[model samples]
Target chain A: MNFFLGIKIFFRSLFLQSVWNYERMQNVGFVFSLIPFINHLYKDKTVRAQKIKTHFGFFNTHPYLANLLLGIVMRLEEKCLKNEVSQEEVLRTKTMLAGPIAAIGDRFIWSTWRVVCSFIGVAYYLCSGKEGVWYQANIFVGILLFLLIYNLLGHLPLRILSIYWGYKYTNNVVDKISKFALQSYIVKIRNVGIIILLFASFIYSISLISDLKIVLLFWLNILLSLLLSKKIAEVGIFYILFLLNIIILTVTNL
Target chain B: MKLSLWFLFISTIAGLFHLDVMVFGQFMFSRPIVVAPIIGILSGLPEVGLIVGIITELLYVSIIPVGIKIPPDSTTVAVLTVVCSERLIDIPVALFFAIIFGFLYKYIDIAQRSFNSLLLGWVDTAKAELVEQRVNLLIIYALFITYLKTVLFYLIVLPILSFFIKQVFCCWIKNLWVHMDLYNLIYILPAIGIGIGLAHFVEE
Candidate 1:
């Protein structure tokens, strides 16, 4: 039946996953977590360990680089499995590529694209005439599109990096990229630059709030921040904002 | 095949109230794009239920469990929440369910820690045995405790919760959530965008 074929596809995907699937069963756990029923089949330790590695692999890279690395690794996994490459080579290749891909994916996909999409989604939600399933679906699709396209493209360079330069070459490529990204993002912006950017953006966002009372409530937050600077937890900002709104509602006739 | 229904029913009931289930705690099993829909059919309201489940899946896509920390278990939350809303009420309600599910996830973490403690105890017992047998017992006991506690919790609690939702409550508890608002929901989109942007900005 079709059900059997589906199972076959899933297994093939798993196999494809294994080639670049360095994290092993952890990815399986992540993939299955999306589904509602089959989380049980992959319950054993071997599976869990594998998936955990894949899931936590992000810590190794810049967000964008991590996604790209994963994409390439995924492609590599598929092609290598189909070609019946040796297990030892696959292991060696993975050990080599994992670090570099993680770096790239983190920088490009996780860092950059995620921020861009989130802002777009937020803007759409904030504006009128954009409040329905269609809008929601589009936002979701936007996120998916970024993940898919960037990841797929990221793999292409990785293939060349791993194939031509091999492990050392790949490491060199990662090192350069990391050095370049860090210099540009952190050094160029610096602390003052980031603070200015945050202030500007914060002001722009506050304009969208429209409700004067709400604006006033948030304005108080600046003073609250200074007053509580000694012991204020970042999370307390959210709580204070929430409390402010409740207090405002109770006091105002509107 | 019949057992699938048992899993479906037990998972749904256990998920319905956010109660911790035994044995079959792996609700993520039902989350596949294909499999979840099929399972939804068995439970009734197949179409909406499946779609809702998928939406829930997408919302929590990036959330992957690692180490001892368990992210919110959306499997039970998504399935039972969708089923309850469609049969008894509506779809927007599922969002509220997602939030509550996020909180319940903390307890699941506690359960995992408890499970790990039992594993440590087994390791101690294994230490006293022969070196060869000790290794085997350690692996066996470790896996056994992991699987057993989850399964046992689901089997005992799920049926009881199901009866309560169906017979006693008549889904009344859901009414308490009706006043919840969907205002500023769209803000989450831009928040994600900002997060993504910052992430990218930082990386490069």
Candidate 2:
């Protein structure tokens, strides 16, 4: 692929879900992303049309990791055009890799990395043991830290690098990802998140400790959340707490 | 700045950041942690945004947007919570209403995706030359629709809801809240979020 065409497709991948639909989620976005590449590779209108149609099946993956798949597909298409690889292999690669890539992206990005970054930010905000003090510059830094670390370190570079790795490694990209041992990193990150969260809670508890009942109440709610998250939505838990608040208000005329 | 100006500005910001949720790169921009504080700072109320953003983040920490499951729109809740609090609404009450609206917004999200399905047939049948332009058109339509829906909702609903909550609920609950010491109740929200997040770490 021409370097400029690769750059164009990378930019287009940012809009990978601009028109996601239930029937073929991300298919439109995929077609839109690959159009520049198709135009670059195939001159004949008929072949370009056939190539476009080839990718028009159900396609959904975690958006960030989808860049890797895009790279691999582009590489596959290049080989297919030269009759080095069969069209079926190109299509199969897209379908086969979609599930695993989505799983990795969802776990790493959504479940692990996002949680870690959010807690790091939240913990910083509460670290000073101040409540309702919004003017503190530390809190601003805290939020900014989350955004900066998450994007600069996690999302932005990963999107760009995944494309490079996927293209360079081709079908071996998954094997490369495995060698990186993302699950172990996820475990370490989750552990750090848990520590930061606990420490932040401890800091907050110090400020609220004057009211022993309130501290106990706070712990109770935490216990409730831990127990109820699977069974109830956050909205339901929120209202339930409100209902409990009504009872507490009625029972104790504080 | 006028309240109308604030509404328009915030609506625009909300729409832009919300694009991160699904319409574009999952860049974490739409996460409550990122948008809430910025939106909060923009509205001249940084504390409200930070606290709401933190609590909201912890609250929904366990809810992952994996696969077919459509979890509650925590980003919407964060944006609405900060926006609602900016109008001098009580943080807890503001959260209540925002959660309701956020719940409703999830349905709107599902509906928008469903509507996008309408163009699938055309995409399948279009000629090659037409396919590129048509896909481009569809993307613009999808983005425009999402942005417009959020902007219109904020423009119309925020004033009425803020007024009613300020006039009606605040009047009744202010003294009661002070007496019961539930003002500290907002603190517990983070605990719940923290707990849920802990569960995710343990289980996931």
Candidate 3:
């Protein structure tokens, strides 16, 4: 029964953002996903309704990392039902865990893993070149590779492991997560992946700029880009480079 | 370079489903990298879509939607760029317009989120009335509103924009392409990508 509940919750958790709103922000979806477990646990309709209503409070987190919170909350709620813990304790657990997990999740998944995968995807797409069926085939392969690697390696495993660890460790879940040092590992892996991908991109960029003057202009743009403070949006830098490209091409006729 | 209603219809629907990623699957089909190429293929120009998608992806690599901060809607920008410019405008020019549209659409996304709060009020009423099923209905309503926003934006915006590109920018792009070394233009894109990649390290 516990295994079945875990399976159900895991599936439901994937839809955690379905009914997102500014006010409560995933509160509805959170409640929705927990409904089956709540139903199974509570015998009385009133108590069940009360349990469900309690979850209607503001709840937001990184959607993938949310499964961990869900599992921990489930354990806390079970204790509450058994009178081993108070209702306030359960609510407090939810509030406390949400923020930290969101921070980690956003950093690891959104910033690191996503950027790494995209760098790989862009590298593949660029190296495939500009024309013919071969290029088209490579584009499709690159997209498929991105989705597969990201979902299989990063998303699905993290979600399942989060749920498992959250339930098994309960209140000590943070310690368990820290002990594993998942964040550091992710950062390390991402750093290596990005370095390799960036090297490939660098070589590709060099090969594309065959003319000497254009190479000088390219290096100038790189230096100029490096000088621009990080406060400026990367998109803005791209536009500047694009405009420079047009001007250089027009003037040099290379 | 005439607009194909068939492509427009398909793109609108795909765009609507893609917006559902925000609320539903989060499967990332809604991402510019994915959606742009799909649009390209549907419009029978997968190569254009793929190239534009790569540039857009690299350009926006660091801009993830963390917490409540909504980034520019690059997916829409990408779709519009690929679909509207098919044979009319140069890819680079189309990309420029798409970036402009992307910034504009960010405000639209914010407005849609604000509008969603009103629907949340309705969900609250349903909960208070003890009509449990109505809560589900409200969730569906929210999803529908999201779908409507994407479809309406695409349907209303794309055709007119395509027309404008055809009339105003086509000749200029054609002239630029004729005068410039195509290799230089092509090389510029990956150069931007490399710069952005290097910048990513700096930001970190």
Candidate 4:
């Protein structure tokens, strides 16, 4: 691949979720990102259009890791053009790779990395002290810190490299991804996230320390959250607690 | 007049954030940690935004939008909550309305995704010429329509919800502030979020 075409595919891959329909789920987006590659591979309009038609099948995967699939598929399409690989093999690779990549990407990026980074950001904001004149400046900095940590450490490298890695390894990129032992890292990050969450929650809950009743209620909230978590999501617990707080405060007349 | 203009501004920004969640890269930019604070800072309620943002973020942090399953529209909740909070209505009541809007917004996404399936038909049967151009156009049109749907959702829903919450709040909680410790309630809301957040990491 030329530098310009790689750059084209990289940028175009960012729009991989642009038309995420429930029916086929990112098939159009996958085809869209590969347009340049198709045009480059097939010289005739009929052939190019036929190649496009072949790729319009169902395609879905985690957005960030999609370039890996795109890169692999691009390579496969090229190989198919050369008659070294069958079209079924190329299509099968897409369907086969998508589910595993999506699982890894979802667990790593969505479940672990994003959670850990934002937990740190929220911690920073709590430590910055929310009661003073500098709170706005503090929030601004906290937000900048989050956006920086996430994009710089995690997002940028993944996005810029996913396609190249996929193209280079083709079907074997899973071996490359597995060699990282991301499961261990995901566990470690989640453990660290727990620490950050506890410490930050402690910091944010400090104001209630002076009010004995509120402190008890705060601890009780934590216990109840733990107990009921499996039964309902945090959001549901949030609503129930919020309504209860409002109701108790008003009914008891504080 | 100034407040009206700010509402317009906030709603427009909210629509863009929704686009980030749906169409654009699912960058953490669309996360409540970012969206709520931006709306809050712009509305001169930075602290409320920060607190609400934390709570909303934690509430949503565990959700994975895997496969075709649609997560609740937490971004919409954060955006509308921050926009309607404190200035137009009380935070707690605004939150209730915002959560309702959040659920309602999912219907919009469901509808948009279904419509996108129709657009899928266009690409499935495109002529031999300029199929790439047709796909590009369809993607752009889908994005534009999603943005418009979200913006219209904000424009139409924000006012009605705010009004409804204001009336209910005034009748119930507004005059009851003599017995209310609003800050306590606000502080505990995040405690619940943190508790739930803890549950997320600690389990399994």
DockQ of each: 0.07, 0.66, 0.51, 0.69
True contacts kept of 1: 0.01
**How far in Å is the alpha carbon of A136 misplaced in model 1?**
9.9
Top candidate, metric TM-score: 4
Give the per-residue lDDT of model 2 (tens digit) for B122-166.
Answer: 867988677777778888887788889888877887777677667
Candidate 4 local distance difference test against the native: 0.80
TM-score (all chains, Cα) for each model: 0.40, 0.94, 0.91, 0.95
lDDT of 3 by residue, A18-49 (tens): 77667788887788778778888887766766
Question: How many residue pairs collide in each prediction?
Answer: 74, 1, 1, 0
Instruction: Candidate 1: list runs displaced more than 4 Å.
Output: A1-112, A128-171, A176-211, A214-240, B1-204
By lDDT rank, best first, the candidates go: 2, 4, 3, 1
**TM (B chain), model 3:** 0.86
For candidate 1, give the docking quality class from DockQ.
incorrect
Off by over 4 Å in 3: A129-137, A206-223, B1-4, B87-89, B127-131
Q: Pick the candidate with the highest lDDT.
A: 2
DockQ of 4: 0.69
Pairs clashing in candidate 4?
A: none
Q: Give candidate 4 regions above 4 Å deviation.
A: A129-137, A247-254, B1-4, B87-89
Best-to-worst DockQ order: 4, 2, 3, 1
lDDT tens string, model 1, A143-166? 344334333444334433332332
Better model by TM-score, 1 or 3?
3
RMSD of 2: 2.2
